[model samples]
Each structure stands twice: as structure tokens, then as C-alpha cells.
Target: MTTISQTAGYTDLQTALKVRARNPALDRLRCFLTLVVLLHHSVIAYTYFGHTDPKSWIGFDAIILSTDSFFMATFFFLSGLFIWPSLAHKEPWIFLRDRLLRLGLPLAIAALTIIPIAYYAIALRRAPHISFADFWWTTVTVGPWPSGPVWFISVLLAFDLAASTLHRLSPKLVDPINRLSLRGYERPAVFFVFMLIVTAIVYIPARVYFGASRWFEFGPLSLQSSRVLLYPVYFFIGAGVGAANFDRGLLSADGRLAKSNWAWIIAAMIPYCLLWVLIYMKREILGNPVWLPDWYEIIYGLLFAAFSAAILFAILAYFLRFKRLGSSMLDPMQAAAYGMFLVHDPIVLWLQYWLFDVDMPAIAKALIVFVLTVLLSWGATAALLKIPGATRVL
Candidate 1:
């Protein structure tokens, strides 16, 4: 029943989707997020809430709060954007193999090697004389096996597995979301509101029940309890957006979503400011309770969810708006970004440990750590990529 013209249209759409899938804008965004991750860790030690050294800055607390609210969730969304297309192209077994090789292998390798090395700096601060062997044994064998940032990797692999199973059962499961994405082409605010509601629904209850600081942890496997469902919401929504017709959907470079960057910036700033107001209330008005009331948790959670959604849209729009200007500063690190993410924790940690005793102001120490961590991690990733057959995994 298909006409020649119809077939041609379909083919053209497919080609466009392929091009969009490989969009430089998305790559640049991922690289920017990676840098944000580095910046986040670089400054956390200096934050008022998490001060591990003599110097502490309230400014870093604001930065941490904003970054923590959005970055990992956005990373999951980006990871999901490519999943359905990848699955459509490869055999199930091949897809599984690739996911395992890329995600599983890194997780296993990092948990054993990189994680212990990074945590050793923290351990050294406490015991100062504790041997690496002793620290490693206690960490791996005894308890509190910290995964650092690679928890995201482990959880992502699990989501990929779940997605594979769902795809096998019904490829159309996400069709409704894809349809909504198409609608987003004209009215991105609709899509934004949808994501805000969904993320808030999933995130708020768990946050109120589990509180913010709780993590479900077991020997190198850990996740923030509240985010367990929140991340999957973002991931599956991204999958829906990317399920098909990626080039023509909400993220189309020419779409209103791209043109509406400023709207989202305003949207993001409102909730972000409100979040700080709540923070002030928690500390100044509520006496900084050990556990905030459920009402406080609910309101904070909603604001966090709103801010996250708006910022995601804003960042995506910013990139898409400038996507045609061609190669970016972020381009140079595109290939190495993943490797940089995997390896940056230890570099940042050790750099902080070295700078811990320095008499510099908090901002000075943080900048020194941030600049050095970026250079070192980039160099480390570049060197790693030179290894034979490393590109496939890195």
C-alpha cells in the first residue's frame, strides 16, 4: 500500500533522525555537564555544608545545591535519548554486549581500582598512617564501599537492561511520550510542565520518606534513595522523546524548544531562588532541625524538581540555538569526556587533599583544584584513549 513518494519521505525522515542523533549540540551539552561534574566535586570540599578543610564558603553551597539537583538526572536523560535507536539498529544480544562492555566493565574496573584509590585520600585524612592495603581491605571487605560517581554508571546499566526487557515486550510502550514530544515542537512549556509534574510525583514522596541524605548502599552499589525513581522517570521520558522521529520532536534545532531558551532560564531562576528561601527557613527559621518536617520536604522537593526541568530545557535550548555555529570549545573534549568523568574523582580528591593545608582562601583553593583537576583528568583520559582498543569502551 506504500507509494514511492511515501517511501521517499520515510527514508528522508530516517536520514534526518540519524543526523540529529549525532548532533554536535548534544555532544557539547554532555561535555559541558562533565565539566560541571568536575566543578561540582572541586568545590564541594569548600562548601559550608560539606566543609572537610579549614576554609569554607557559602557560595559553594549554592553551586552544589543547583548542580546536585539537575546534573545526574540530565545525564540519565541523555543516556536514554540514544537507547531506543541503538536497540533498533543492533541485535538484542549485540546491544547487551555493548552495554555490558561500556557500562558494566567500567563499573567493575572502577569499583575495584579507581574508587579505592580516590577514597584513600579521605582515609589518609582520618588515620594519616593507614596503609593502602588496610584501607582497601576494610573498604572492599568490611563495609561502606563508596562508589563515588560511578554509581550513576551502575544504575544506568540497570536501566538499560530494564529498557531492553521493556522493548522486547512492546516497542510501542513509549509511543505516547514520543507523541507528546512532537507536540513539544510548538509548545515546549507543555512538555516542561509534564516533566516537572512527573519528576515531582516520583521524587517528592521518596524524599519525604527517606530524607535527602540517605543512600541505599551495599558493597560498591549505592544510590541516593530519593533519586532511585526520579532518575528512571527522566530516562524513560528521554527514551520516549527519542523513540522515533528524534529530529522532528521537542528537541528539533529549529523548534520552539530551541528558541525558548530565555523562557526556561527565567523558569529555572524562580524555583532556584525559592529553594534558597526554603534553605534559609530551614536554617534560620526552623533552627536547622535534624530532620525537616514532611511539609518542608514536599515543598523543597517540588522546587527542586521544577528547577531541574527548567534548567535541562534551558541548557538544551542554549546548545541547539548555537549548534550551527559549528565546532565548539567543548568539541575537543567530546571524545574524552566519558573517560574524564570516570577518572576525575580521584584527581579532584587527591588535589583537595594536597591543598587542604594551604592557607589560601576557599575560592582560591577551589579554583586551583578545579583548574588542575580539569587538566589532569583530560590528560589522563587522552592517555587512556591511546591504549589499543580503548575507544570502544572509553
Candidate 2:
């Protein structure tokens, strides 16, 4: 028979293990990305290059360009970082059930309610008297259902399932990448180059084939054609890094990757500038043709992939380096971040709709939208978490 002291020791050990499983740096990084998502949508309507609002600014164009280039791919990579470990610990059925609750439930709910409400703001711009009843009915029953940002949730769930299946089939498949991650602790640039090459291989041909504006869509499911494979490449690379010896791998706090943050920033800037150069060539030199040439697409795609990979390393390095610097504004919002992401689109779109005629500068309107969206969405998530058993899904 076990003594009470022994049982208590066992319980404490289990608690410590659970706490150790959670990474503080990654948590804060995730929170920061959630805020980025809000800011991206809030200012997108005001970008001078793709202005949807009465007021527009070139600065917002730069902001959107960087965020659009890497944020979603980074999100998928961050998500993949824990997949192998998760599948190792949980029973397959248990893993699936939890993923369904966390991802699938939010996806279904958001697609049916939040997404329609959000897009309706745009619909009203086109047709002022369109009733919500008519719009919702047509959106679900007929055609043109958009998933909004919740498409990330649906796609992430699919990737998780595929990863689990792959893991069960051949546990050692990601061993090569894991080995590279271990080596990255000493020479981070090698890992960086590897990711750049892989992403370019998967993304360039697709960009040339799809021409950058096409999306594969069905009801509430949609993915950008050029990026459909790029995301999974990041996903699996992340999985490989976390597959084994995670604490000793590329992202280790003491690793060269974290120590060399400035280098990654420079790496990111070069390709980003080249990207703008390509944009200039398209508009001024190439006359903004309906279809850009294959040579142009190939060059643009390679630069985009390089920028994406470099920026990801830069961000992870920054977070890992300063991870021990104690509490942050981001800490308080970390738990609420996912809920905020799910709920913010409607709040932001509605705010933009209301502010359309406010007679303000582009920056001022964007500022107002961003601040209010953060506050309202954070408050809404807090309230939603108060409902009985809501925390499980949220």
C-alpha cells in the first residue's frame, strides 16, 4: 500500500511535469502573433496600395506586406512545434477528441456565426438594405461562404490529424530535421538556409502556376493556392525540431539562434527590399500586366520564401532571448489571445464600418479601430469564458 507522503510526492511530481511541458517564450510569442492578426486586419482597409477605406497611407502598405508574408506560416510552424510530443503522450482517440473541442468546435461556430456577421459589414457596403436574415441564409445555403481567419483553425486541425497519422506510420521520419535542429544550436545559419531552400522549392512553382491571387474555396473552406504547400513545409519542419531533444535544439534559449538575433533581422530585410523592388518593376517597368511573367513570379516567390523563413527565425530568436525578462503586457492577455483571435474579426469589421464616415486621418482611424478591437474582443472573450464549461472549447 502507498503511504500518504508517497502519494503526495507523486502528485507533486506530476504537477511539475505538466508545468514543464508549457513553454513561456512560445506562449508570449503566440500572444504577440494574435495581436499582430488584429493589427493586420485593422489597418488593411487603409493601405494605400489596396485601399478599401476613404483614407489611406503608404505606411500601412509596408505593415501589411510584412505581416501578410510570414504571419500565417509562422502560426502553422508554432502549432507544429508541439505535435510530435503531443501525439506521443496522448492516446490517439484522446488527441483527436481534444483537437475537435479546441479547433473544430471554434471553426464550426465561427464559420456559422462570427464569419457571416463579419462579412456582412462588407455586404452592407455593396447593398445598404440587405437584411441579415437574407444574407446568412444565402451564405450558408447557396454560395460564396467565406471562412475569414477561422480558416487557420480548420487547416490547423487537418494538419494535426495528418501529422499524427504520419507519426504513427514512421516515428523516425522527422529524425533528419531533428538532427539539423540539434546542429543549429551551434550553427543556426545552416538551419536557416535549409528552411529557405525547402520553402522556396515548395512555394515558387506554385506561385508561377497559380499567379498569386487564386484561392481554392469550398463553402467555408479556403486556402491561397500558392501557399497551400508552403504552410505544411513549415509545419513539418517545426515538428522535426520539436520531435526530439527539444530543449537542446535550435530554439534553445542559449543556442546560437537566440544569440544571433540581429543577423536574422538583416537576413529578413534584404529579401523584403528585393520584394519591394519587384513590386516597383511590376507597376512601373512592367506596366502592371494582368499576368506577370514567369521569370518575375519565380524571383518574387524565392524572395518571399526567403523573407518568410528569415523573419520566423528573427521572431523566435527575439522571444527566446528575452524570455526570462519577467512579466509583460502580453502576459496578461496570453490566455485570452486565442479567444480574441476568434472573436476579433467581427468587432474590427463592424468598427471599420462605423468609422467609415468619421472624417479622420488614415492613421487615426486605424489607431481607433485597433485599440477598440483589442479592448472589445478581449472583454468579449472574458465574458464568453465565464459560461459553464466554455473554457474547454475556448
Candidate 3:
């Protein structure tokens, strides 16, 4: 009996290790991406191009540009990874209920309260005498309700409903995508090319017509017009890839994606450089035209799509390659990452508001904001999770 107990203990330990081995890396990646989101917002007011605040820096412009180019779309891709397995296991109503609780609740809370408070900083700067209550009420009732980063949650819920319908219509709809994913094990570039083409085709026309800087903002629903179709494409592709035999697909440790990490790095750099060239052309050659020609938008849009795809490929490849390594800093922070994302925006904005009067360079101010935002966001998330049943949704 003692010997059998020892065998059972060993079996449990092995089971635990096997479970953690595959999941930790992806969890770490999500945490890191959340931090990136914080950093992106912290630096935005200081970017030379935006110049909303006193401090301005060209480096911040580059940071914001690069980040905006890929982060949201990549987020959709990451969010898609577990959808297939989730749908396969849960009843449709059960899944819908969970999504509503997890996604809808947060979005509603953020849009109604947190987002208003965050944007209140901007409003105060614009009109110092306006009371918070008045601003909040008018904002909520009248017009221009900014969703901020919580926009992703609302959009994701929509995608989940759409994907649910597709699954119900034909469970085998993703079979071809799974086959495409199988090819990625040896030739990951095939998947990369397919993603690039689809996004470019879907995105370029919308970008050219609507132009960049325009968002369909009405109440809590808002998204970049160009990315509406593009984001869904990436999400659906991710679902298809994860639909079957996930471990043997592109994310597999032994796949060409892991082996070609350096190649993907090079791939990411080329389009990034191309984007800068186009920027130079816009500033110098086009004389910074307010109304850009369709040809320029088409070319720039195509390059943007390529850059976006390559960077995602580069990030995924690098992560896959190092997934077998020991634990990372992101491991300890993983639990709070989602909460951090939900809360960080307001923290960063408030900090910026307080610091606006201080004498400091853009880089220094941005650094301080990023550091404080991270610590405060993490602490807030931890504290919130201690509430009875808060952890279930948060």
C-alpha cells in the first residue's frame, strides 16, 4: 500500500508538470503583451506627432506607431487561440453566459465608469472649470463615449458570437484551416503569406477610403474602420489553426516557426523599414498632404499589413523557441495581467494629469508613468481579486 501511494504521488507530479509545460509560455506572453499595452498608453501623450502634453519626443512617436500597427490585431489572434476548444467543450448557452459575464460585464463597467474617469483627465485639461459629474453625465448621455482599450473586449464579444454561429452552422468549417496549419509545422511561411494576403485585401480599400484617424465612435462601440475586417480575419484564422491537433500545428515547439525565429526577425524588420520610408515620403515628397492620394494609401496600407503580419510571426516564433526554458518574470504577473489591462489606462492617465505641471523631459515622465502604472495596476488587481467572487470574472 505504501509503494502504491508513492507511485500515485509520482504520477500526480508528472501530470502537473505536463500541464504547466505547455501553458506557462503562452501565459507569460499575454502578461508581457499587457505590459506593452501599458507602455504604449503611458508614452502616447508625449509622442511628437500627438503632442497633447508639454513634453514631446520623436522616440515616443516611433513607439506609438509601431505599437498601434500590430498590437490590437495580434490581441485578437491571441484571444482566438482557445476559442475552438472552448466551444467544443461547452454548451452554446453556457459559453454565451460565460462570455457575457467575463467580457460583457467588464466592458459595461469600464465604459460606464472607468473609461469616463480616464478621459476626464483630458476633459479637465480642455475645460478646467467643468465639474466631473457634469462632464460624465453629458458624455454618457449626449455623445462621444470613448471605450478606450476596453474597445477590444466589446469587439471580441461580437466575434465570439459570430464564431459561435459559424460553429453551429458547420462544425467542420475550420477543417481546411487546420490543414493549412499542418503545413505550417514545416513551412510556417505558408501561413504567414496567407495571413498577409487576406489582411491586405480586406484592409487596403477601407483604409484608402475612410483614411486613418477616423473611428466610428458612437457610445461604447468604436473601432478603427480599417481593422474591422482585418481583425476578424486574424481571429478566424487563429480559430481554424487551433481547431484540431493544436500541439502539432505552427505553435508546436519543433515547428519551422520555432526554427526560423531569426528569419522572422528579419522579415519583421524589412516592412518596418519600408513603413519609415513611406513616412519620409509623406513628410517630404507629399508635402504632408491632408488628403493623400489613393495610390499612396494602397501602398502604405499593403506595407502596414505586411509589417503587422511579420511582427506577429516574429513574436510567435521567438516565444515558441524559448517556451521550453525555465520560468520567467511574466509567470508571477500572469494572474493580474487582465485586471492590469482593465485598470491601467485610468491610472496612467491620472498620473499624467498630475505630472503635467512637473518639470521633466518626455522620456523621464513617460518612464515614471509606466513604472507607477504597472505597480499600481498590479496592486489594484490583487486587491480587487480578494473580494468575494470577484476573481471569477476579473
Per-residue lDDT of 307-331 in model 3, one digit per residue for the tens?
8999888888877755778878777
Identify the candidate with maximal lDDT.
1
Candidate 1 local distance difference test against the native: 0.84
lDDT of 2 at 30: 81
Worst 10 residues of 2 by lDDT: 1-10
Candidate 1 vs candidate 2, lDDT winner = 1
Q: What are the Cα lDDT values of the candidates?
A: 0.84, 0.83, 0.79
Task: Output the better candidate (2/3) by TM-score.
Answer: 2
Cα lDDT tens digits, model 2, 1-394, are 0000001111111121231475678777887888888899899989866587899988988988898898888887877777777778778998798888877888899999999999999899999999999999999999699878877776778888998899899988899999999999999999999999999999999999998888888899888889889988988998899788988989899898889889999999999999999998998999999899999999999999999999999999998966677777778986677788889988988999999988999999999999999999999999999999887776
- Per-candidate TM-scores read 0.95, 0.94, 0.93
Question: In candidate 3, which residue ranges exceed 4 Å CA deviation?
Answer: 1-22
Q: Can you write out model 1's per-residue Cα lDDT over 1-394, one digit (the tens) per residue?
A: 0000001111111122442446778777877888888899999999877799899999999999888888888887887787777667768998788778877888899999998999999999999999999999998988679888887777888888999999989888999999999999998889998999999999999999999988888788788898879988988998899888887889899899999888899999999999999999999999999899999999999999999999999999998875687678888987778888889889989999999999999999999999999999999989999999888787
Flag clash pairs in model 1.
none
TM-score of 2: 0.94
Backbone N/Cα/C clashes per model: 0, 0, 0
> Any idea how many clashes model 3 has?
0
